[model samples]
Target: MDVIARAGRGMTRGQEFRTVVDGAWSADPAHRMRWEMSLAFVAASEAISLPVQAGLDIGDRTPMTAMLEAHFGCRFDTTSVDLDTEPLNVATRYPVVTAFEVIEHLYNPLHLLLQIRAALDPAPSSRLFLSTPARKPGFLQSPDHFHEMPRRSLEALLSRSGFEVVRCAEFGIRSPLFCLRGVRPLLRCIFEKIRIYELAARR
Candidate 1:
């Protein structure tokens, strides 16, 4: 599939992996793991235990996608997709698939998950990786996200879509002192974390 890049609601343009992660973003190496990039990647990576020649990446390419390429020792394929509108019916079923911080942007995350189940390799060892913000109070949530699901809600949706959670974990992006900074930090203490899940399609 050809690359299709588009900006968000008011963004001037979409940013690529080079622009968004490697170039524009940096954190102190010492504590970089506290960043969402490190947090999401670590969680997803640690859960892997399979060989992959090729894979599918469900969202736009990003640093995490690069890491997946490294983890699998091969380049994963990506398509021009608008998860909110299009069904992800790829001709090839992938052994590994990733959707990093993307599902929350959709109005119907379940629709996309169903497509993913269909698109993924059906072997028990095949994996679908996903990451998104955990539930938050309305004031702490991003305006663009139409669905900020609690853990159970997300699990239920995935289950209904023919996937079963194999492994999952959550980690915060805030510094240790963040909770002491202000009300927002205290709030972020709970919401700034990202939860990552590894799933296997049901038989």
Candidate 2:
């Protein structure tokens, strides 16, 4: 793990905590969770328009980068931060950041959010788009999830991190497999049981 100074703050720290939440990018592409997240990625791509965007997830295995580049002509960066460091010390800033189903895997999600907020472009139009599991009674969240979040709690966290909740809602994903190609199905899935949050920096 590398130790480096955080951007702007100038505090030296070790590398981010290491973990592999979703490693099987190729072994089983038909998994329901993958499809659901893919739908979320598509929805986020369509809803947010930025010339450059960054993905903070661990691995760049999916076609999300390609899709965004092809559709929006956006430059995408999968490397801006060291994933082994705590609270995400970003090396660059961007107009938009996408962390799909990532916060739930963090032990200090709030800290990460704050860092992301700091790394944002700081314009009202700059945004952070993220998704995580919605906490529900008797719901079986993934084992990798460190903390499942309810909608209100998530909104509160965003507010505390200096972000305004533009849109935060729970959606259900029934047919995660077939919904990846079309927008309507993805939109329907977003309105179902899955949790998707689109937030804007307060600026």
- Candidate 2 lDDT, 27-93, residue by residue in tens: 3433355445654555654445544455443233345555545554565665434332554555667
lDDT score of model 2? 0.56
Off by over 4 Å in 1: 1-51, 177-181
State the weakest 10-residue window (summed lDDT) of model 1. 4-13
Best by TM-score: 1
Q: What's each prediction's TM-score? A: 0.76, 0.64
Q: Could you give candidate 1's per-residue lDDT for residues 1-203 as a string of tens digits? A: 22333221111135431112233333433125533464355445544554576888775555555666776777877655656567665778887887766677666678778888888776777788877788988889876666689888888888889888877878777766768998887888867777887888889
All predictions: root-mean-square deviation over Cα?
5.1, 8.2
Steric collisions counted per model: 0, 11
| lDDT (Cα, 0-100) at 103 in candidate 2 | 69
